[model samples]
Target: MRIGLLTEGGYPYARGEARLWCDRLVRGLGQHEFRLYALSRDREQERAGWVDLPAQVTQVRTAPLWTAEVDGTWYGRRARRRFAQHYGDLAAGLCAGPAGAPGQGGYSPAEADRFRSALYGLAELAREEGGMVAALRSEEAVRALERVCRAPGAPRAAREARVTDLLLVGAHLEQALRPLSLDWYEEGELGSVDLCHAAAGGLAALPGLLARHFHGVPLVVTEYGVPLRAHYLGSADAPPAVRALLAAFHGRLAAEVYRSAAVLTPGNTHVRRWQERCGADRSKVRTVYPGMSAARFAGAGERPGGRAGAAGAGAEPGTLVWVGRIEPSKDLVTLLHAFAAVRQRVPGARLCVAGSAPDPEGAAYLLHCEELAGRLFPGDPPVEFVEMGGPAAPGLADVYARGAVIVLSSVVEGFPVSVVEAMFSGRATVSTDVGAVVEVVGGTGLVVPPRDPRALAEACVALLGDPERRDRLGAAARARAMELFTVEQNVAAFHRIYLEVAGRCPARRIAEADAAAPRPFAVPAELRVAGAGSVEVTR
Candidate 1:
């Protein structure tokens, strides 16, 4: 079968979140033909270029979501009216609120219908005309936005939205709708695909939706981290009006996508719950965990600390490893505070934070952590901070193999790939209670309350004090990882799911043809048989 593999800022990019998993999927499912539809996040990502794709991947098409290039073709007189009506409804719906609420600024069924109609109408318009960038930035666009924001039943926040706010929201919407103008839905491209597998929602899934609309293809949506959720989380600092408008738009889009999809695949139960809350059909929702490559950890799991002593022979036995990107969300500050508590009891205990900062803020945070660690410890193990950059530390397996215990202090997470990797390495883990961490650990590690340094310290001490218990937990973790989280198992599950979806869906072109074909009304007299006094029908 031909598959349209859709992604945003991932897969084919050298540095991306889902690149490795997607590469593995394509390589493993060699029998299926794949056409990649990727949305590049930035110029840097485009410069990084694609990873070496396998022969199974038949074609690749990409567009940028990070920057908007103006396609300045104005709609004709009649098309302008259509744009006004549809774009007005879309802005109005966003200005009101999400569905199922009944009050001022809340959505109604009529409004929802209006939004859907308007959205697709605009998409159709974009397909006919060049693009909507110039139009979306027009005075008419701002006026429509103003009308919605100042509508009678508008949200208090939205009503306060300034011209600047309207412009920003309008600009974003313009870029997002650019996908509507893409010529990918032509017969030779996405139209020929048997299935459209969107890697995530928002702009990434736009092509998939178009494919389903233009062709009769089925769409499968997978969300490891819900884009709507990320938008909500990241927009905390934005002005209330901006946040409200963006949130409402994304919420409506998510609902529409979920409603239209043949199936919804979330990486964990946490994400599945979010999808369900967003109006995804329970029957269509499936939790498919992201698979980790376990080959690197095979020796580590099998030997179980044989290399631990070799690397840190003179160092303390109670060394804890925290490995991941050095971001504030990881709650490294809490981890450092927890380590101070751990040191109060076990003075020789060491904490090795092994990972590099991804951004300048993270780099500054790392420096702050170092300063805090020095102030807390005053001398001793010196808070070993290893930035795994060059040939010095080639990969994560070496990092995991050198430590007696692995720690996760994140206050928020989705599936916690680091925790799973630690499990694959057969390391005893101590993780805070957060998104899917407990579910991933599953009694194979110690769980603590998030953002609580005291509890985190206590858990670490408990794991560190008992070698036998650590070994037992590590063994259990490795067993669990092997049983549930291997790349082979994940791919096999998806393969089955793909077949199941295909079985349920009508064959696109063939079924359409069959539906349109005329049926024979009667059988030939020679082929007919007599039953009692009546003539029987025969094929």
Candidate 2:
């Protein structure tokens, strides 16, 4: 099978989300040919280069989302009229209302159709007239948005949009719609693929949506984190009117993608809920847990002394381990306070925070956490913040092995990867009930409410005091991780999904001649079977 794998700001980039899993998926399914369509987030990511490609990956096409230069596509009078109609409808979709609202969610069937029609209409125009980069950034585009905002029956937020708001929203729309102008929809390119598997939602799914529209290719969308939710969370500081428009735009786009996809694979039930809330059909949504390698931690998990056995000779029985990217969302301050309570309950309890500060904001947060820990514990603080992969914190399995109780104190999270890793390492965990923590934990470990130091501390103390309970929980967690979160299971699920989707939506035949076109079952089963002495096959 020929699969077009779509991603945004990820694999095969050296840095980004879903890179490792994507690499694993492609490598695992070497029987099928893959063509990669990746969108680079910025110049730095592009400069960082990509991971090594396997032989099965036939081609790779990438575009930068950071830059939108003038493409010099001069539209004539007829093209201008076409652009106006499509752009008007698109802007109107944005100015409608919030997504998933009671009645005015902005994604009624008529409204969603209008949004999708306008999007594909623009894509067709771009294909016919080269590109829409120049037109999307033109004064006419801003005027169209302004007109839509002021139109009768428009939402109050839309009506309240200033000229500056219109311009800002318009610029953002250009970036989001930039995928429409890509030259990847040619018959020999995206159109030739049997299946378009989008690695994420939002912009990453845009190309797959286009391919399914332009070519008869089937689309399968898998989302670990819903992009619409991320957009809403990230755009909180934007102007009210701008925020409203962006929300509606993304909402309508998500609804359309869900409606069009042959299958929707969400990483967890938490993500599935978000997709359903955005109008995804329950019948189409399937929760596929992210695949993780367990081989590295299997040896540690099988040790006799349980958690302490893997922690080496210097292992601390009461140590609490926290591993992840250090950010405000992690709420390390709450973890520090919780540790203070744990120390009161179980004296000499140590806390180890091992993760990297990805940005300046995270670095500042880390510093704040260190100071808070000092204030809580005073001199010779039992709390230690170690940079992941540094001298203090060597590797993931090693870090997991050092502590009896793995702790997750995040106020906001998606698919809690650290918890899964801890589970794989046969360590009991205490996590806050946020995102997919409950779903991932699945009664295998203890979970407390987010931002509650007392509850978190109590959970930790219970696990630390009862070695037998900790061992039982750790064994159960390892079993659950082995059953549900391994690479083999993940790869197998996708492989099955591929066949199911292909069976339902037949691949587009490449040529008029049967000899040139790829067939689903080209070779007869009887002929392919071993030890069948030249068996006659009937079609």
User: Model 2 scores what on Cα lDDT?
Assistant: 0.87
Model 2 TM-score, 2 decimals: 0.93
The all-Cα superposition gives candidate 1 an RMSD in Å to the true structure of 7.4
- Candidate 2, after superposition: displacement of residue 13 in Å? 0.7
Per-residue accuracy of model 2 over 1-539 as CA lDDT, tens digit each: 78999999999999999899999999998888899999989999999999999999989999999998889899999999999999999998776654454322235566777888999999999999999999999888999999998999898988999999999998998998899899999977898788899999999999999998898788999999989999999999999999999988888888888888999999999999888877788888778999999989866687654432332222468899999999999999899998999999898899999999979999999999988987888879999888985666587788888888899999999999999998888888999999999999998899999999999999999888888788788888888899999999999899878777766674355652446654543221121223659554322
Q: Which pairs, if any, clash in model 1?
A: none
RMSD after CA superposition, every candidate: 7.4, 3.8
Misplaced by over 4 Å in model 1 are 98-107, 304-316, 510-539
RMSD (CA, Å), candidate 2 to true, equals 3.8
lDDT tens readout by residue for model 1, 1-539: 67899998999899776888888888988777889988888899999888999998879998888877677687788988888888898999887655574321235667767777888888788878877777787788888989989989899999999989998888778777778877788767888777899888777888888888777688999888889989999989988888889899888788778878899888888888888877778889888888789988766777554432122222248898999888899999999999989988888788889998878999999999888888887856548899977577657887887778899999988888889988888888999999988788998999999999999999999888888788888888888888888889878877766776666665554222434653221111112334776664332
- Candidate 1 lands at a TM-score of 0.90
Residue 379 of model 1: what lDDT? 54
For model 1, give the 10-residue run with minimal summed lDDT.
Answer: 519-528
